[model samples]
Target: MSKKNKKHEPHEEHNDESWLLPYSDLMTLLLALFIVLYGMSTLDAKKFEELSQAFNAALTGGVSVLDQSTINGKTKNTPTKEQDNQNTSTLTAQNMTQLQKRNELRKQEEEDLEKLKKQLDQYIKQSGLTSQLATKLNQSQLLITISDNALFPSGSALVKPEASALAKALSGMLQKFPDYEILISGHTDNVPIDNDQFASNWDLSFARARNFMEILLQNNKLDPKMFSPIGYGEYHPVADNNTEVGRAKNRRVEISIIRKYQDPDSQVTITP
Candidate 1:
């Protein structure tokens, strides 16, 4: 009985620290939440994209557009064919402007050429030499024929002293134009020459051409380089060889003014 009583009377002192267990558990939970938030903030974009795609595949039914694609929050549209046509039209307008300018310049040049031709015709008519002198117009040149009696002496190569006034009148008109080429040619009748000074018609015809060329060259107003002289001794006959009237016409000098253009009006091309 004494042993049992001693065992029961033996008592232990209790320490109370139960609140620390719950507090430790709360701190551990807060630490875990902060770590999860940090992981979300520093997420890898590529892996995150793959994870989001897998999530959408598991849930969504429609193909949705990417979030960042809607820049300026506007709907995208395709370019129209009309815009391309307008660009082409602008280019065409620029080309047309250049063409118009070229066309205007060409017109101006042709007008100048026509006026020159008219001036030459006027001078020929006003000099009262229209009958003996004739003008032949064509695409290549303008030919003016003056009789031998008007330009030179019989069987002589010398250009007459009085011819200078006539040549000056012609040269003064021609000096203003440098764009054309001038040719003075001499021709003779079929009859043979019997002069002591020259042996044949060829010599006389050539001398006549040379003398006329010299006269034109001496004119300070005319350009010497554009003038050329040629002789045809009864070879290039313009009229019948039988009649005296034809022979007189054949034995003459001719002046040619070459044309610079085919026509007064024509189309022009322009490039940029």
Candidate 2:
């Protein structure tokens, strides 16, 4: 028996699943959104910013989403209010400690100056040089006054040959305060002076101050930078120029040691 001829059957049509591609992409975006939300909720500020940048790059084609939220067209990484307050408090505490230490050091400097003044006074008394020397301690400086005759001859700026011993003694005392600033100021009587060596009182006084400072700086240990010489030229007189005794007092040299603690805020200085 011959088989009957059969016609080819057509395949049945199924529903289209083309929408799944876009749907999957939407789901991926939703998942990224949830992750960013969770990161923000955790209050992890650093991690949140990192996640924001990552999602913005992945979802927005590398354009930053946080750029729209920027103030003054710049991103600010500002600390929270509580953190700022804590930092301020810590800084205030550090400043207070520094202030306290400065105050303590100032007190110690004053005490050292007082002790040095006493020692000098005792030396002057013992050496029988009290008539030629005097010491006074004030807020700004400790001044040592020496009669002109003690260091120089009449109308001469050169230090006396014997005064070298005195200079050495002073250097020994001053070595204890190596860091203190020293000022040697020279003053002359108002009498008109004209000599082959000096033209006027200004030249005489300046030469006297410089000569005295050179003697003090002869010690190898003393810092020459800490010393300065100034001349007052009979204008700055401690006594009247008209009298013989007053003129003698006016012609003197002053060695002033500056105080270490000079408070910028205070007008009153430590004195003894």
Candidate 3:
């Protein structure tokens, strides 16, 4: 019985599946790499140390990798509240020093003005010109008041020759205060006058102020820029216009030494 010659059937080869194990292992490693990179990118210093400590605990039974980086047993670059307060105190001290300097300068100015006033009063007493000349110091200025009869003739704008001496003396006194500004102001009584020399009190008062200012400017040491002339015709009177004595007081020339320093309360701020 020749079993119909055993047909040698060829066995089919099966595809090998062993490579899947390594592929899955590679995928897991890549995922772990991506997670580590993401954690590194977002971690702050404190959180980064915490994460490192966790890794250390898992790997080495709780030894920390960040233990050596701590300095002076504290975090670096963090200022305490006391340090901020010290900075503020330094600024306050500087402001107080500046305020003291300003106050000292103000006091010095007051002393200088008082000395000038006393000197002017002494001159008026010595020259027996108290009735004709007077000095008054107020908040805005030191004013030297001269009577119309002392400086000019009736109905005249021209300064009298005798008054030149007085003007020269005043210029000499004013030379000591080169930084001050001088204003020459003329005032007239309410009486109306029409004459060949002047048509109105305005014209007369302005001319008188200008002429007197010219005398004051004769000193070569005086700065012309520091002086000004103004005329108030029958206006800004210090006395009543109805009486002769008041009229005489009203008709006068004033030399005002304007104060360079102004009081804080009276100061005006001009906005542009």
Candidate 4:
């Protein structure tokens, strides 16, 4: 009886390897789980497509494959839905920051434009030169027009005595704002000009513009670096030169103040 009991005990010892089969399967499943996570972290489009299709075909409803296996005899695997939702939230935050920054820039530009308009109005009123001056405020700059009848003689670039005070006043005000670009532009009516000093309207208009630029520079109201003179001899007409009123309006010298990004439309810049 003792010998028979010993043989049974050895048989029981040989069958103990049954426990190891299930343990081996558990270890394989764990290895597959880690491999799937690593692949997701460094995914490529081709492999992702293959994996997605294989997992979908292996599972019900193409998802929720906790009990499903792949063609390679491995279980389906992926992150939880909650984890994907968190990643989406992070992306949304980054997008919102970019939009907010753009809005801030637009707000700043609008403020600048309004400030320029206010300054232009005050300068015109304080100088008491409204009768001789016409002011235009646009998205890019401020344009102040002084009629040719008020500034110079017909077909001549010579500055009149009455125009001296007007020019000086404008120059003084401009001197206070040195950060602006000042453009002196000359225009002429459609009337022809033939003279010893100026052969055509173009010459007359250009000379008038250049002379005014020099005057502004000499008076310290403009910096030579930020000043330019252009002549549009009968080319840019504010009114029809055929009519008396139009002719008067067309024959003009304009001092344009280019705004420096304070107008809402003038600043298309980014923080970077």
TM-score of each: 0.55, 0.74, 0.67, 0.56
For candidate 1, write residues 107-224 as lDDT tens digits: 6555655676677678778888776677665545666778898888888889899888877877777787777788788889999999798788888888898888788777787788
- Determine the backbone clash count of candidate 2: 0
Give the true-structure RMSD of model 3: 9.7
Off by over 4 Å in 3: 1-91, 267-272
Sort by TM-score, top down from the best: 2, 3, 4, 1
**Model 1 CA deviation exceeding 4 Å by range:** 1-113, 262-272
Q: Candidates ranked by lDDT, best first?
A: 2, 3, 4, 1
- How far off is model 2, as Cα RMSD? 6.4
> For candidate 3, lDDT tens digit of each residue in 189-232?
99986788788888888888999999988999899999988888
Best lDDT among the predictions, by candidate number: 2
Q: Model 2: residues >4 Å from true position, as ranges?
A: 1-58, 61-76, 265-272
- Give the clash count for model 4: 3
TM-score of 3: 0.67
